[model samples]
Target: MSTSTISLDHVVAWLARFRELVTEQQSYLTELDSAIGDADHGANMVRGMNAVVEKVGAAPATAADELLKSVGMTLVTSVGGAAGPLYGTLFLRMGVSAGPVAELDGAAFGAALRAGLDGVVARGKAEAGDKTMFDAINPALDAWDAAVAGGADIAAAASAALAAAEKGRDSTEPLVARKGRASYLGERSTGHLDPGATSSTLLFQALADTVTS
Candidate 1:
């Protein structure tokens, strides 16, 4: 089962693993959000992820774009609030970057991931140190690019990305919110670990699990 590229099957597995992780962390996510947000981060992701799996898992995608597009559209429609649009934009941009391929080599995957990260930034208008998902996502992209450039396999690169994501997520704990609903809390946002950052970390973890599993 040795492979150098991420095939459609791998993408599907990534989505499935992500769904499982989000569902498992739903309550924890909500609890994290309760301190700073509307308290729906967990449920929104779970609902969106479930729909993504139901759609993408139901049938094997003939092309990578097909599956990714389905996932993006589903997330945008099913999930509520900013999470839906931001997450959906990620998949949509990934789909666009993936083209019609059935598999993605390490470099191709990196490019697609970078595109997805850029899309989130464009849609969210947030950056690192903003105490938002960008904190995790930006670092994950840097780690992914570096890992792949260093000649790591997709699995190894994914693991690196996840580790970076975790570090980014943790780094959010002490920062005061500069964006989103949490911004209104001002100084009060400093102590709480950002829920968006936490969930974004899960996204990379799911990618690593799918590649290694």
Candidate 2:
């Protein structure tokens, strides 16, 4: 596969892979959430991603922005809880940053990812160590930028991002929650892995799979 640029097909595959992963891990996600939240993270993500894939399939998009925006809107409307708005904001901002394009080069994709991360922060008001999705996403993007700076192609960059995301996700396990429903547990949140970070890891894993496969 050519790594110089990622096309709309790549994006669509990424979403499909994400949906597959979330469905496979739905029970694990819900179990993690049950320990620190309302126990709906897995089911909500599965439902949302299923809707996103269906919506995208129904309305074929000619451009990256159009496709991404459709995905964002579908998730926002179909999913419930914080996951809907935060994930929606991420994809919405990414689409806006990508503009009217059929494909994205490494730099363009990285910039769009950064924009999405910033949007997530704005929507969730989460920072590093907040034990939220930001922990995983931020580090993942940082590694992405670094890989791009080293002239790595999309596959390599995505691999780097996934590794960083997993590390960040693991890092969340020891921290006391400072945001979202987990925060209510205080010290009780210390031992369980964060549902948001875990799902965010799946997001990158899907990206990696799409590019490498």
Candidate 3:
């Protein structure tokens, strides 16, 4: 368990991992959406990630924050629905948190992620137990923070974060929606997992896998 610094290469690698996972889980995300939303969350994320990959692959920007900001802008324009704004804001805030030309270590990465989560909260105004991505994301950030505070290595901290995210994603299945379009269904939203949370979990998994890899 050695602590390592995060570099621009790591950021790009994680984005690549995210692209792969989103593509692989597209149908799964759509299925989750079919239960609660417009049924396009998966497709939207896939489309957005594809655009992001293409952008990142073509030029390979030198600046990590600029690269992430580009990703955020691409998603904002390409993706539709709350996913567009929420995910866009997350990346945008992450880019801002990382700043220009600054290296991010395990603790810095955790802090950046927490900042991104705060941006999500500001943009979506959703909280934990709302049957939204916030449920997964918040717990994941908390776990990351706790693990990092406990002197866990980046890999171990990220693993813990991803596990918390997955559990939070699963927990969404039994809860009635308390936010977003699904909330409109009241109790009918029960028994269906939130598509947003599922995708968010995938995002955390991608981060953990990329960093560990």
Candidate 4:
């Protein structure tokens, strides 16, 4: 479908999915986080996403960019720890790149997501192998770009992206921490999965499921 056909409903649906997924995986996320970081990533994310859902439900935004920006701001204000600012900035940049639109096509959405990743990089200064969210998000965006270049539909492209993200998240388990709180642990962080990578993977999975279903 065309980008213009992606209504505000799509954005709302994606947010809902984000809340649901994070809530469902809260314990797992927290467990993973506790190993390397402060152990509040999952709980913090759930709290932030729930607040986002409430905000969206109370006064639904008409524009896609506005809705995303609202989500980003809510996360920034509600969630604690480094995740709050990192993820918050990601969405804020996404909103800016998306502009005040009602809809977006696969290519436009991909570009907006890439912009978000750029923001994450700028804010965190973490590279792909740093065992951060970039590990998952970077590969996911790359896969999406590849899928789009291959003339895949949005749903197909999103699916590919999610798969790549999941793989990236999984791959972080054996990595030595190189950024953020986990890096403080040095070699001690080698066996644990990165909480940020896990959450980032969930975010893309939610987006893929929401738009396709």
Question: What TM-score does candidate 3 get on C-alpha atoms?
Answer: 0.96
1 or 4: which has the higher TM-score? 1
Pick by TM-score: 1 or 3, better one: 1
By lDDT, the candidates rank as 2, 1, 4, 3
**lDDT for each candidate structure:** 0.90, 0.94, 0.88, 0.89
Which model scores highest in TM-score? 2
Range of the 10 consecutive residues with the lowest summed lDDT in candidate 4:
1-10
lDDT of 1 by residue, 52-143 (tens): 88887677689988888889999999999789999999999999999999999988888887898899999989987999998998889899
lDDT of candidate 4 over 48-93, digit per residue (tens): 9999899989997888789889888988999988888998998899
RMSD of 3: 1.3
Of 1 and 2, the candidate ahead on lDDT is 2
Those runs of model 1 whose alpha carbons end farther than 4 Å from true positions after fitting are none
Q: Model 2 over residues 49-160: C-alpha lDDT tens digits?
A: 9999999999889998999989999999988988999999999999999999999998899999899989999988898999999999999999999999999999999999
TM-score of each: 0.97, 0.99, 0.96, 0.96
User: Model 2, which residues run further than 4 Å from truth?
Assistant: none
True-structure RMSD, every candidate: 1.0, 0.7, 1.3, 1.6
Off by over 4 Å in 3: 1-3
lDDT of 2: 0.94
- Compared with the true structure, model 1 gives a TM-score of 0.97
Clashing residue pairs in candidate 3, if any? none
